[model samples]
Target: MQKLQFPAWLKAAYGRCPDAIPRGLQSETIAVEDACTRVTSEPVRACNAVPPWSVAARNGYAFRTEDTNPVPGSRPSKLNSDSDLLAPGRRIDDPRIEPLEPGTAIGMNAYGPLPVNADAVVPDDIATALDAIQYKRVLVRRLLPRGANVIQKASEYAAGDVLLQKGQRITPERQAVLIAAGVRELKVSKRPRIGVVVSSYERCAPLGSRSCWQTPDACGPYIRTLIEQWGFEVAQIEYISPPSRAGSTPQALHEAEISYRRRMIELAQRYDLIIGSGMLSTESHRRVGLNGLSWFAASSSNDEINISQGPGSRFNLAVSRDRSPPRTEKFEVKDATGRVRESHSIHHFDRATFVNLPGFLSSVTVLMHVLVRRIIDLYEFVETPGPCWEIGELARDVECDRKTNLMQWAKIVWGPRGEPLIDPLPDQEPHRVSAFLDADVIAAIPVCRGGLAAGSRIHFLRLDPMRQPAAPNCAIPQPIEIITEAHHSTEFESMQPQMNIAQSWSCLNAWLQSMPDAIPGGFRAAASDDDIHVLEAAISAKLPADFTASLKTHNGQVDQDGVCFEGESLLNIKGILSEWTCWRDVIANDEFEGITSDPDGGVKDDWYNLKWIPITRNGMGDSLCLDLDPAPGGTFGQVIRVWHDDERRERVAASFEAWLCRMVMDITGLEEQKEQKEQE
Candidate 1:
């Protein structure tokens, strides 16, 4: 029987399909600073020439090249050595502002602005070359060129020159050019999101059934790592170990097909590309059949390894938009010699492109390098499309016992001479998970040929998923606000010693004022400063900054549905005083065992001490309190929800400000904030 192959099948498919690859990628604006390794969607041109002026290239004295002629042997020019020629405050007036004629030496470096009249620059070492007499006179040893030691305007790039070209990655160097060009924004190819699935027909047999679904050691691990390193996102990639009778009964196969088809279409909806690996039914882990390809049971996916049409091809390129997948695809299976063995039809999506890799060693070997790599290249616009093979001599004897015509791949590794030495691994065999480990290079052994020697030269690409550029991570700067006069005045007024707490209730009132539809009327005004002062004196503890800040602005509750365990309202100043007394009466009899769980982990000490201030009622016979054990110079303000059992005290925030911010977010924002700042 003749050998079966993927490349040939792919070629046939390509001949039947359109030559043009379908549209897949889209363009988006990415901050120039956040664009390292990102491909340019369009050319990034400079708005203005770099430097904008001819400037000195080094630290030296600028002067007329004409006067420096025959320097060591000629009379010293009368160029004034007056360093005072520069303006005060480390600034140099543009030469246009103050002209300097020949013989006038201006001291400057690359960092300093160019003077309008100065031409060449003599290095500081010019002093060493000259005698003591010439040194004192600030003279040079030779005549310099017209633009010597000077960086001419636009020398790097002029206005409208491309700083970053389309299809190019913004590497560190390219990023620097954009920065120098003052291009803070640009367009980059959007990173494609991918999804991977490993479906097992046996999966129908209840989950965790004898671990038949054991994950492959080398399966999608390297693929995912490489894709992520290329800056593409992989939604998920998993391995499902072999087994099952999905092929036994037509009914079982039907069920499997239906189940897997639904799964594929669902994932296709969410990911740009889908690479699904099937189960390892055969011992060699290669022969793919209906059970293996059942994941896309309705699609045109045949259990054949055919990614060589690669990513730049029609199907792969469809990732940018929709692939317009056929709702169902028909497949006819042929024996090795070309006789039809079976015919089947499977469900496929109209938009998702799915690749099926059968459970075969040789198949994995061939597709892993060629196809997967092309996908990454197309996704990232990685300029280099591959077949970058390297030549190397075999260090050891190669075993060639096969008599079949099937072309296969064997894993190889490098030897001492920098040449990739073949460390031959088994091929086309069932489940050679061992080969999946400890190998890098691959060598193709032809039919009817056998080296069986130690010095035969073999070719392979030195491609290793580990060697690609790691994903680029650029940090974003948070916005910082500058304090305005209004802000300063507000702070000053709010902090006045004579001001009563009730007088500064604008903050809470203002917040309430803006939110009328808010859980109506549970909140009220704060107590007077004198009243709060009396409470503080009784507790002998200072309130946290955030707690006080909120009280000044929002000292009341409005939650009718209740924000806690029961329908308890947020406490106003008067409510707080009342809640404080009721809590005091209970704690007087039983020991305070309130141990609040810190959001950052561990227990907060003495959480329910009399020092804690009340914020709201729990209605479950407990109240929310603000712990205010001021740090020597700091104010205490951690929010804690407490219960009477002296148990289950949950610390909500580190400060009142944080607590208020969280509450505001809860009321207006969608999620609760739980920030754990990492220790430096």
Candidate 2:
């Protein structure tokens, strides 16, 4: 039988990829107004305070705290807008308020400055306004509260405060904030230029004439859109293809590689990061098959996790290529460190990493998105932290393109004591909520599933090693199986889910073992302390014999920090509470009688004393009542809804799409359609 092994030539090329480009200058300056999407080079602080002067907080008046208050049965006092008679103690700079009789009148304008210790009375209280000048001062009202109707200096942002942080991409809101903080312009990191290398030439030309097909320029524009979505300001994108004359000649391929490399080198100097499309492949010509585009086939190593791990020994081991191909292992390559001095020839390794991913264009789109985003983060020397509670199943579902199954997913982001930090959609909200989950048919399944699932293994080893796993996701254990509704006599029939589970678990268990430094016996460590407890509970669940033993042998310690298992959760509400800072009071307090739905109805209905439980954690609070048109339902002329955590909201959206795709797949029965059409 022919061995299922990667090509030797592909392996050597990948083993020598470059670690990073040689240092080069690619400087350019863009106008601040034209710099949207550019990464910020440095932190931005406020140039000056907002509202440089003490401005009116409300249109009613501006005044000092100390003012005149009307005393019972005393002589009345009359005051005018510009006169100092309204001053406290009848003294302009006095600290205490002067006592006056109940019948008193005063006047003031909203922005007019108050004399020291002199307060101004608003028109609504002293006199009703017919126009700007005609304030008819009536009578002295109730006692005025201290510190009312005044805005202190520096109430808004103060000068020198950091308005935007370094490394943050500029957004409209950020721009507005900077402007509010008195920034007229900003210095930001230049958006990186991209150089694309596509191999569109034909392998053989007909009678010295070139093939009509052009490399699909579709990728070029699509890439632009994707980068913009990632929130980067793209400076430029340039497309360069292999020479059209290089077909059917040995020199043709070599020349193409060299020419493209030269162009990339030049572009690299002008770009912060150079991103190329396609051309990391073994094939001389483009192939339509998905397998033909796989990263593994094109390059020769599994470097996804390595790029994300950081600059450490673990990362080095992940990308190492000195070892020989592994024997009897699913993922194995030659090690990268040891050099073979065969006679006069010595081989030296290159330092860059190569990633091979086999998928359809749509799936590739998502994968590239994840890859580029993570890469940019890595290039900046930061390991982007994973979400507190990732929707692993949903992420898998989306990756597998099983869109319809995602409708059932839901996760809550909460504070300690079950208090929700995000608002949930109110029941009366006019939108359907749903979730989604899916199974990974490829890669590792846990061994607890059993059988081919139990003993199956895959590995990734440096070099063309004989004992490493074949690929990242290959050799997954089968899905878990449980005996449900089976007859007392039929053992296999009784446990469908259990049987599947055993198969998946065994496969995954064997596969993970091939990987180095995994929890001994195919177990992994938990992500957090809380995960340690949940890991035990999950392992204790009824699983396949082989899978259970693997767990038992590993002592329930798995690489929880690496990836979470099905039942384990990593979020800690306590951490969020400890990190809590300031919050704005976005509450409303108003006595509401129902207002007429129709403008023509002059009569106002008594405001409904709607008894709504405050969305509270501490004390009583309220939401202001605003006039709104009610739908046909008599239920709550008012509406209330809660907030959703970010991750949960993203999952719910992804799940809904997955669910739709699953429904379509079910109805089409695509394989059956393909067969039927073929028979015709």
Evaluated with TM-score, which candidate comes out highest?
Answer: 1
After superposition, the stretches of candidate 2 with alpha carbons farther than 4 Å from their true spots are 1-35, 65-67, 70-77, 82-133, 136-140, 201-215, 228-239, 242-256, 279-360, 377-680
Which whole-number lDDT from 0 to 100 does residue 200 have in model 1? 48
How well does candidate 1 score on lDDT at residue 49?
Answer: 79
Give me the candidate number with maximum lDDT: 1
lDDT, candidates in the order shown: 0.52, 0.32
Q: Which ten residues in a row have the lowest lDDT in candidate 2?
A: 308-317
Scored by Cα lDDT, where does model 1 land?
0.52
Candidate 2 root-mean-square deviation in Å: 30.8
lDDT of 1 at 183: 89
Candidate 1's displacement at residue 382, Å, is: 6.0
